[model samples]
Every structure is written in C-alpha cells, then in structure tokens.
Target chain A: MKSEKQLVELSLKDDKHFAELVERYEAKLSRYIFHLSSLDSASTEDILQEVFIKVYENLNGYDTSFSFSSWIYRITHNEVISFFRKKKARPQAISPDDVDEDYITLIPDDTDIPKELKRKELAAKVKKAVLELPEKYRDVLVLRYLEDKSYQEISDILKISINNASVLVNRAKEKLKSKLTI
Target chain B: MSKLADKILKKVKKANIKHKPRWQFIAKRIFIWSALIVAIILLSMSVSMIIHQMTVAKPVFSEHFQKREFSPIFKLVPYFWTLISLLLLTFAYFDFKQTKTGHRHRPTIIVASGILVGIIIAAVMVSVRAPHNMEEQLQRHPLYQKMHFDKDFSKGPGALRPLMKSQANNPLAFPKN
Candidate 1:
C-alpha cells in the first residue's frame, strides 16, 4: 500500500482518487458491510464498492468540513437498510424438500434431528433481530456493535448529535441483548 | 490515530467511483452541459421578456409611456402563449433526446409525459372553447353605445329595472291605482 499522503495526492482530483479510496477501504468496509447485514464476504465487497461509488459521485456536493468517511458511511448504512427492505419485499426463501445432511453438517454445531430447524442462520437471525429494532436504534447498533463506529464518528456519519448517538447505541445494545438472549 | 479510523479511512480511499464505466462520465458531462444550456436559455428569455415589457409598457415613468402608443403586449397573450408552448415542447424534445438511454428513466419519462399530456389537454380545451369566446366578444363589440344610455332616457331619475325588485307579494310597495 502507498503512503496516505501519496494516495491522497494521486486521488484528490476525482475518479482515480476515488478508486484509490476504494483500494484503501475495501477490506475494512467489506467487514463493516458484512456486519450491517449477514451477507457473504463477496456480497459485502460488492455493496462496499457501491457505497464508494455513491460517495464519489456525490463528492462535489460534500461539504469539506464534514468528514468524508462519515458521509460515505451514512450512504452505506442507508444502502444496506434499503437493501434489507427490498429483500423483505421479495418472497422469502423456502426450505428445500431434500435437506442435504451434508449441508447441515457444514453449519456450526447444533443439537438433535432438526428438519424444521435452519442451518447457520447466524446471519439471518441477526438480520431479523437487528432489523426489528427501530430505525434509529437499529442504525446505532449496526454502526456501533457491528461496524464498531465510535459515537462521535457515528454521529458525524449519521448527521446526529453525539449524545443522541450514545443514547441510541445503548438502547440498541439493550435491544440486541434481549433478542439474542431469547 | 486509532486502528479503527485508520482501517475505515483506508477502505474509504479505495472505494471511490473511478472504477465505474466510462459512459457514466459522459452522462455527467451531458447532464451538466444540458442543464447549463437550458438554464442559460431560460435566463436569457426571462430577461428579454422583462426588457420587452419595460420598453412596451414604460411602467416606471407613466409620463414617458403616455405619449407613446404603448398598448401592452398582454393583448397578444394567446400568441405569446403558443410561442412559449412551442419552445417548451422543443426543449422537452431535446431533453428527452439527451436523457434517453436504452432503458428510459421512469421519473423523467413520467414527467415528460405529464407535461406533454397537460399541454395537449389545454390546447384541446382552448380550441374547443375559443369559437364561443370569439363570438361572445364580437357580440359585445357595439356594447359601448348599447349599455351607455339607460333603457328609458325619459325617466330622469335613474330607475333600476323592474327585475331588480324582489318578487315578494307587495315587492316593496303598491299604490291603489
């Protein structure tokens, strides 16, 4: 990887700079995206790339005082929310008739004969549970726990006050804790 | 300074839209240029219209206008309107051509369709109603004299018509004779 100064120098003009920004952010952003939803790493990468694309296009309108990262993150968060909403609108996945024993084996350890049960379902589980939270609270949790953004950073990203962000995050944690415990 | 910021920033740097196809750049240029051109045209026409109004009306100094036969261009509203309609359609056509893609943008398409439909509806309504209006206006032509004198000039006191009285039993009053 190039030095930050070198990369910034190369990219400040526009698109190429944006590409550089992507190259710099993809891995971590992908992880963040993954946490935002239970998407596979590849899907996460794709979404992360998309978020950057939006950022690049909207950069001209972006105020210099606001952190670019925050702006991009908000866009990314919005995109993920929209994605889930779209997914919800679609007909849900039906369980296959011939449940492969091998497929079940691939998923992490679980108990006895479970034809009615799901496999892995970690991503699905977290998605549904997290999504059940109110939009603001849900966003705070997704950014804080899943994306691990600081309150200040999340506030900047979300265009919200830091205190509000903190309150939301704590509320989100409680919500998640309750859902996960059950 | 922290690893998280460092990490997020790193991703941010890599995520810009340079990787997007070349056509997108062309699209941006086209939008910018076309919007600018339309904006310039609109501005120029507006200014020209304003100037024409000022010259024709001499609004600011009534004395300057009194000597001139500066009847307002407002009387030619219909003609001006037709011209504006034509210009709008032409602009819409160009915009449609410019914004056209293999797959049309639904919002833009709907908006264009709406404008076209609205214009057509208005034109039809005007065409349908215009003859009646023309006839009515022509009928009222000699009204300058017809309405100027009272029906019975012999009656000095400006008596309103009998229809102006309420149709109650006595109306207002009745003499025995």
Candidate 2:
C-alpha cells in the first residue's frame, strides 16, 4: 500500500491512482459529511462528489508539512461551509437516530442511569444536545468525538490554533453537560 | 472500487478535469507571501515616515506649545501618516492570515507581532536615515511641497526667524552703528 503522499504523487500522474485515493477516503468523508450537514443522501453524495473534484483539482496545492487526512478534512470542511453559505441557511441539527451508540459514551456526563431503557433515553437526549450546539461548538465536538480526531488534527482541519481547539472541546463538553442537566 | 469512487472517476474522465499545474499553486503561494512581505514593507515605511515627521516637527511643536500657538501644533502631528500606517497594518494582518498556518495564531498575536516588526524595521530605517532621504525626495514633489511646506512651518515662528533676524541688521534701523 502506498503512503497517502505517494498516492497523491501518483494520482497526479494517472487517473487510476486517483481512483485508489478516492476509494480510500470515500466512506470516511461520506460519513463525515453526513454527520456535519443536515443534507439528504443525494445532497450528501453531491457534496462528496464536489469535495473529491475539488481535492483532485487542488492536488498540487497540498502541503507536505501537514498530514493528508487533515488537509482533505479541511477541504471537506470548507466545501460544507460553502454549501451552507450558498443555501443561505443555518445547518440544521443531525438526527439523533443517525448518531452511533459508541459516540454517546464520548459525551461527558456524570449521571449514571442504571436501567438500559433510561440509558438509551439519555443517549438520545445527549445526541440531540450535541447536535443542537452552536455551530462552532458542535463542529468541534463532532470532529473531536465522532471523527476521533486529535486536537492537533482538529486544529488543522478547522484552521484554528491547537490551544483554541482544546479550549473549544472543553467548552463544548461543558455546554453539553449543562444542556443534559437542564 | 467503491461505487462512489467509480462514479467520480467516470465523471472526472468525462469532464477531463485535470490537476491544476503545479506552477499555478506555487504562483498562488508566492503571490500570498509576496503580498504579505509587501504589506510589511509598506507598513514599515509608513511607520518610519511617522517617526521622521514627529522627530522633525518636535522642536517646532514645542516652540508653538510654549508660544501658545495651537494651529501649528495640530498641523505638526503626523495624522495622515498614522492613518496610512494603520491601513497598512490591517492589510498586513489579513495577508498574514492568508498564509497556511497564520490562522493558528490569535489576531492579537498577529497584530502585536506585525506592529513590533514594523517598529523594529522602521527603527532600522530611521537609523540609516532612510526616512530623511524619503522626506527629501517627497519635498521635491510640488504637491507634497505645497501641502507639507505650507501647512507645516511656512508661516510658523521658525520660518519667520530669518526675516526677523535680517530686519534687525538693517542700516536704516541702526544708523549709529
């Protein structure tokens, strides 16, 4: 398996290599787009296509100093923002049902509901709370928790300082906990 | 291959979309960096001009203050140059923000550093008397001369001192000597 940078170099030379690159990131980016936007599957696919096309077009612009994943994520982040801007609409919250159960554990909650039924209820509430956060906080929380990105990676993707990334995550968590309590 | 990837590939092939040539990206990066450097240089020059104006006008300003002449003191302040410096600083800030990692810095840090760097460069320019040379060059321009010479010291006590001194030596006034 070629490293991502090698793949990028190869992709520049041949469309076939670009296919491999696309395959590698397709599912991950699709999921990311789905999580970040309130778009339907068709719109998600449309946005994904635009993202890949942009990625392909700007291949030469990618800097070697940053990881390819972060760079790609950053592009996807921008594309999604552009999508929102073009529509002149605020990003609606993600549906709670679409959130994975594993992500529910990531939300910082001190409450220990004993029953599975109550736990599921709390999970739905937490998911809704996470999704409904102000865009800045929600974006950081989703990238940090759902995407499992490090603060440094989140910083690069969001074009924020590492210190700011961590600060946003902490604030997001605090906001989530307060929402849950309320 | 994933269906989405295949579809994208087919679309890319159909549309004949190609990676933008490497030089274009390089040119873009160079343009942004060049813009940032130019903004900094301009900012430095503006700051140096302000410093030059202040130093040159300080004595005149003090004299006017002592004489309770408010008009020349106000004219001596480098308001125009200060405004130009501020505008250049803003341009420098935005240019720095366009750099790859510029967003990683806080606005306060970027602005503070820009100001600090501008001051340091301006200080160096002042040390080499660059601002004085620039002022001399500017003085030759008719418009600069008109605006600067007329508003600055043309009617002030300093400009009148020669006339005042020359009159005191007139033979008609001191015929005994």
Candidate 3:
C-alpha cells in the first residue's frame, strides 16, 4: 500500500487516484463525523461528500510536514462546526459502541470475561458522561479516547496548543470519573 | 467504494476547484499577527497617556506638592481612552484565536498576560516622557492672570480659612522663598 503522502502526490496528478484517498478515509471519517456531531447516517453521508470535496480543493496547498490524518480531521472538524452553526443546534449524544477494548483494563483488571462485561458497562457510562460534557471538553475527550489520538494530533486537529489539549483531557477524565461514580 | 466516496468523486470531477496558493494563506496569517501587534501597541499608548496625566497632576518628589485636597483634575482621567484600549485588546484577542495555532494556549491567560505586558510598556513610556507639572502649567497660563483666582482656590473653599488665620498670626504664613 502506498503511504498517505504517495496517495496525495498521486491524487494531485490523476483525478481517479483521489477516489482511492476518499475510499481509504471514508469509513473512519464517517464514524468521526457521527461521533463529533448529531448528524444521522444520511446527513453524515452528505457532509462526508462535502468534506472530500474540500480535501480535494486544498490538496495542492497541503503541507507535507503534518500528518495527512490530522489535516483531514481538522477539515472535518470545521465542517461539523459549520454544520451546527447553520442548523443552530447543539450536538446530540453519541450512541454506545464496543470500541472500549483499550479502556477495559482501566475498569478493574480482574478475570478476563467478567471484567470485560464490567468494562463494557463502564464504557457506556463514560460515553454518556462524555456526551454531557461541554463542547470543548467533549471534543478533547472523544479525540483522545475514542479516536486514540495523541495530544499533538488532537492539538493539530483542534487548532489548540498541546498544553491546552492535555489540560482538557485531564479535566475531561475527571469529569468522566465523577460521572461514572455517580 | 462507499456511496459518499462515489458521490464526492463525481463532484470533484465536475467542480475541479484548484488548490489555492500557499502564499495566500501565509499572507492572511501574517496580516492577523501584524494587526494583533498594532492593537497591543495602541493599548500601551493609551495606558501611557493615562499614566502621564496622573503623573503630571502629582509629582512624587516635590516638597511643595500640597496634594490638593479637592482638585477637579482627579475627575478628568482619560477613562474613554482606557475603554478604547480594552475594546481593541479584546478585538485582538478574538482575532488571535482565529489565527493558525492560536488556540493552543488558554485564551484568558494569554489576553491577561498581553494586557499586563502592555501596561508595563506603557509605564516605561511614561517614565521616558518625563514629568510635567500640570498645576505649574495652569498657573503660568494667561487665563490664570486674567481671572485673579486665588492660588489656594484649587485646594477648596474650606482650606482658605486656615491659611488666613495663620497669615494674620505669623505675618508670614509661608516663609520668604
């Protein structure tokens, strides 16, 4: 498989190659769109098309220094923000998912099967708490935990400083812990 | 291939918007930064002017400074300029957050620090401008001569009685210069 940079270079030359880039990111980006906003599958799909169009428009100016994923996520972040503003609506809560394997250990680290079951319940609670967080804190929490992004990547995507990203994550964890204990 | 990808690919083929030059984005960021700098400088200047006015009204080293008990100059502070400076700084603050990478630091801390730095610079500017005695300037003006207002008048009407009684008792209320 070609590296992201290679795809970017190839996509610039041949329009067909851009489809590959879109296909590569489509599922992840769609999931991200759903996680980040209140958009349903239909609306999410519509916005995904818009995001890809924008990504294509700016491909030539894309700086190679940053990770392509961060850049694409940044664009998606902006698109969702604009979408909310246009609709004059607050983001709705995300549904529960089984993507909490990484956080399962944090639950208790007991027997594998029962701990897994407990972890899933805790994960659902955490996700619900995350949805209740203020937009800023929620964003960092989602990017940090759900997306498994580093502070630097979160910073790049959200256009915040690494220090701020760290602060937000710490604060978000505290909020989530408080929520779970209740 | 996802439906979104297929639709987006069709739109890309049909729209074909070219990439904007890198320099344009760079130029926009540069402009935002420059504007923020200019706003800070203006804020500092306004603060300096306020400090200058206060310093002129009361020279700290002068033994003769009677520290007017009720001078109208106290009410004449440049509050308007202070408000303008604050508003300009706020504008700069929002503009800064919009700039690339501006959101990394906490907004309150950066703005507060920027204001503190502006004030420090303004204080330095006031020191460099040197002290001018506003009271002395007012005394030397042609209007003061024409009006024949008593020098003690600036100190309030109640103050005149004490000075009159002292002058009558000592013959020289203030010693010969």
Candidate 4:
C-alpha cells in the first residue's frame, strides 16, 4: 500500500487514485461527522460527500507541512460548522443507539460511579453529558478522546494554538466531570 | 469500494470535478505572504516616523513643560503616524493568522511579537535617519507642505511658530537654533 503522501501525489496525476484516498478516509470521516453532529446516516453521507468533493477540489492547496489527517479533519470541521449554521440549530446529543464500546473509555476514571451501573449505562450517560457541554468544549473533548488526536493535531484541526488546545481539553474534562456528578 | 465512496466517485466523475490548478494555490499563498510583509514594513516605517518626530521634538516638548503649557504637548504627538502604525499592526496580525502555522500562535504572542519586531526594525530605520529623509522628501512636495504647514501655522503652538516659519523656508532646517 502506498503512503498517504504518495497516494496524494498519485491522485494529483490521475483521478482513479483519488478513489483510493476516498475509500481510505470514508469510514473514518463518516464516523467523525456522526460523532460531531448527531445527523442521521443520510445527512452524514451527504456531508461526507461534500467534504470529499471539497478535498478533491483543494488537493493542491493542502499544506504538506501538516499531517494529511489533520488537514482533512479541519475541512470536515468547517463543513460540519457550515451545516449547523445553515440549519440554524446546535448539535443534538449523540443518540443512545450510537453510543458504543468506544465511548466507554471517555468516562474519566476520577468520576465516582456506582459499581452497580453497567458499562453500557455509564457510557450512555457520559455520551449525553459530553454532548450537552458547550460546543467548544465538546469539540475539544471529542477530538481529544474519541478521535484520539494529539494536542498538536487538535490544534491544527481546530485552528487553535497548541497551548489553547491543551487548555480546552483540560476545561472540557473538568466540565464533563461536573456534568457527570450532576 | 464502499457504497458512499462509490457514489461520491460517480458524482465526481459525472461532474468532471478537477483539482484546482496548482498555480492558483501558490498565487494565493504568495499574495498572503506579500500582504503580511508589506503590512509589517509599513508598520515599521510608521513607528520609525513617530520615533523620529518624538526625538526631533524633544527640545520643544521640554520647553513646553518648563513653561507649564501642557496642551501643546499633546499636539507634538504624531497622531497620524501612530494611527497608521496601529492600523498596520492590526493588518499584520490578521494576515499572519492566515498563514499555515500562524494559527499555532496565540493572539497575544502574534501581536506582542509584531510590536517587538516593528520596534526593532523601526530602531534600525531611525539609526539610519530614514524617517528624517522621508520627512524631508515629503516636505519638498508642494501639496504636502501646503496641507501640513498651512494646518500647523493656522493651529500650531505659538512657541513653535518660529521653527515652522524657518522650516517653511528651508524644509531641512527643522531645529533652527
């Protein structure tokens, strides 16, 4: 398998290679869109399509200094924000059905959860609490925890300073802890 | 391929969507960088001019203070240059933020650094008397003299009327003893 950078170079020459890039990122970006916006699969697909089209159109503009992943995530982030702006509504909580094993890890260890509560129950509560937080804090938490992005990557994705990224993550975690306690 | 990817691919193919030309992106990057550099240069020049005016007008300022005439002191300040410098600094800040790694820097850092850099460059320009030369060049322009000197003579401090009168005759003879 070619490296992503190599694939980008190939894609620049031939549209066929762009298909591979799209395939590689489809599942990941789709999940990200779903996680950020609780849009149904159809809406998610539509957003994902727009994102890919934009990525293809601006492929030449991509700065190679940053990771391709961060660049793509940034574009997706903008698209999601645009989606919300157009709809004139804030993001709703992630549906309980979408809350899965991955979200279980998002529950901070410091939280004094009762031993009686099952993992799934705890995960659902955490998801709801997280999505209920302010959009800025929620974005940082999702990117930091669910997306497993580094501070630098989060900074790039969100167009914030690295220090700011770290600060937002800490604040988001604190907010989540308070929400869980309530 | 996944169904969504397949669908997107089909749509792209049907639409004949192509990557925007490389030169357009390059041109945009160049334009941003050029604008940033120009803003910084203009900011530095304005700061240098302010410094030059302050330094040259130091004797006048002291003379006013000694007499306890405080109102004219405010007039000695280079408000035009100061405003220009501030506007350029703001422009430079926003332009810097548009760069690829610019977002990595905090606003305070960018602004502080911009001021620091502008001051450093302005100091260099002052050392070479670039602002003084620029003033002299502008004074040579009939419109500049008419607009600037006429305003000063009409509303200037009585203490500096003699200096302005001499400057009007010989623009380079600013600090007539």
DockQ of each: 0.03, 0.59, 0.38, 0.69
lDDT of 1 at B51: 32
**Tens-digit lDDT track for model 4 on B33-151?**
99999999889999998888788777767877899977767767777788889999999999998898999998999999999999999999988878877877776666555433222
**Kept native contacts, fraction for each prediction:** 0.04, 0.78, 0.64, 0.80
TM-score of model 4 vs. true structure = 0.88
- For candidate 2, lDDT tens digit of each residue in A1-182? 89999999998888788889988998899888866765678878888999999999999999998999999999998988899889887656555555556556655758443455454565666667776788889889889888999988998899888888999999998898887767
In terms of docking quality, how is candidate 3 classified? acceptable
lDDT of each model, Cα atoms only? 0.50, 0.79, 0.68, 0.82
Q: lDDT tens string, model 1, B17-70?
A: 243444665677678567745743443343333233233224323542465523
**TM-score for each of the candidates:** 0.39, 0.83, 0.69, 0.88
Off by over 4 Å in 4: A112-117, B66-69, B136-165, B168-177
Expressed between 0 and 1, the share of native interface contacts present in candidate 3 is: 0.64
Worst 10 residues of 3 chain A by lDDT: A105-114
Better of 2 and 3 by lDDT: 2
**Winner by TM-score between candidate 3 and candidate 2:** 2
lDDT of 3 by residue, A124-175 (tens): 5555566677888878877887688999999989988888899988887777
Q: How would you encode candidate 4's per-residue C-alpha lDDT over A11-78 as one tens digit per residue?
A: 88987788899999988898888777777888888889999999989899888889999999999999
Cα error of candidate 4 at position B157, Å: 6.1
Q: Which whole-number lDDT from 0 to 100 does residue A139 have in model 3?
A: 89
Task: Summarize candidate 1's per-residue lDDT along A1-182 as a digit string, tens digits.
Answer: 66444544455564354456666666666656654455655556556655765655555445444555666677887777676676674213322431222223212233223355455454455455565667787677767765667877787777665667877777776676566557
**TM-score ranking of the models:** 4, 2, 3, 1
| Model 3 ranges with Cα > 4 A deviation | A1-10, A37-40, A60-65, A84-125, B1-4, B21-23, B60-76, B116-177
